[model samples]
Target chain A: MAFQIVINLIIACMWMFLNESYTFASFVAGYLWGILLLFLLNRFIPDTFYLRRVGKVIKLIFLFIRELVLSNIEIVKLVYKRQPQFEPGIFMLPLDLKSNWEITLLANLITLTPGTLSVAIAHDNSHIFIHAMHIDDIDESIRSIKDTFEKAIMEVTR
Target chain B: MIETGIDITLNISVSLFILIGTFFVLSSSLGIARFPDIYTRLHAATKASTLGISSMLIGTFLFLYAEHDIVSGKLLLAIVFILLTAPVSGHMISRAAHKSGVKPVTANRSDAYEDALQKHRKNS
Candidate 1:
């Protein structure tokens, strides 16, 4: 998956080089162009099913951005409150991620969001240890992570 | 005059981004100072800094791309690197912190590690 993304990047860069313009707009154009080309190539090629669903990837990023903004606001609000009312804890999140890469990506995504930091992974790799600052319900938190980030990752990396 | 008007608009938008970015950065610092524990502080520092710095970089990219008509590859790469690695660093820090026995300030309902340790002790 990483290799395919790198190839797409190279193709995007080559597109810009050919166009003689390195502006952001042209770079996006090139990236989309590369994606289209790769999609066509995948249709004809065997065992090259690495590249992702572009729309799903875009949706995942948008979801991440929304989470980022919303969590930032939540943290800001938490910080401004006169009384620090927090329910912070460390909990084990059981994983369904199959690969090391998928687990690492999920951990990173959890940490990158505000109010949640992934502390450790189990020695057996069955669960991830996470510290969340305002977890009203542990099940809900895990459900949201699984539904939003993990689901999107499964979609894109499939 | 028309050019000046465009410049003014660009300047205002650029300033807005910078200001908002700085505000988040400041909030993150405040969080670090005020939060109860190492893990929560790490959360604030990592997330806010990532978004804050990205916002500032976005402002810079927009200003340069709009005003000078050149998108800076270096700035773009910097933003990408920061976004990709911030979480990794946070993960490493928290992992190390936990391994080194940094306890949470007030955990309401969790002792999974302790339970695991007890189970291992009983089995052995």
Candidate 2:
């Protein structure tokens, strides 16, 4: 991804020099041209186009923000309830992520969203122990994590 | 600075964001005191505090950008750093707690981690 971005920027600068136009608009035009050129040349490249990854990253950020706000509201409601009745438990979530950074990001995202806090991970990195504030159903919590944050993370990384 | 319409809008929104941030922070503190166990407390401490600080920093970024026409990189950097580090720190704390055998207060359903540890021990 970084290589593609650098190549694109270099192409844009080359375009500007060739056109003898130094304005921001010309730079943008050159960038567009570079994008088209790169798209056409993508068959020779090893990885997918960089913009697809960028879009996925943006989507992950938005998804995280939405989850954060929704979870915060749920927490607020739980906090203010008179005589709150909820069951908190520690359960293991099986991992599908392979790399260190991806697992770390998954843990961080899980901690920052909703009622779940990542307590520990197995030595082999096969599972993460999560402490959820409200555990009405274990499978439901696991499914939610797998479907939302885990799925989004897989999209971003792999 | 004259109280122009844009200025008024900016001021109001900035203050509003700050106010919302403060509320979340306060509620998080409440959660910390009111929760039963270390693990539950971590949930409150990590999530709410992160959201609170990010919102406040975003407000500050907006205010500076609009009022002074100065793009504050430091504010934006601070927000990103907080978001990144807060969860890691929270994870570390909880991991330590678990390693130290700080059990959840009301875990009735199942503790798969403990089960896994037992299985590993038996296999070894």
Best by lDDT: 2
What TM-score do all the candidates reach, one by one? 0.80, 0.90
How would you class the docking of model 1?
medium
Give lDDT tens digits, candidate 2, residues A122-153: 99999898887767676887998899888989
Candidate 2, position B1, lDDT:
50
Task: Work out how many backbone clashes candidate 2 has.
Answer: 0
Candidate 2 per-residue lDDT over residues B6-35, each given as its tens digit: 889898999999999999999999999997
What candidate 2 gets wrong by more than 4 Å, as runs, is A1-3, A19-29, A40-46, B1-3, B121-124
lDDT tens digits by residue: candidate 1, A42-61: 75644464544667778878
Give all candidates' CA lDDT scores: 0.81, 0.86
Query: What does DockQ give for each predicted structure?
Result: 0.59, 0.69
Question: Which residue pairs in candidate 2 have backbone atoms (N, alpha carbon, C) closer than 3 angstroms, thus clashing?
Answer: none
Q: Is the docking of candidate 2 incorrect, acceptable, medium or high quality?
A: medium
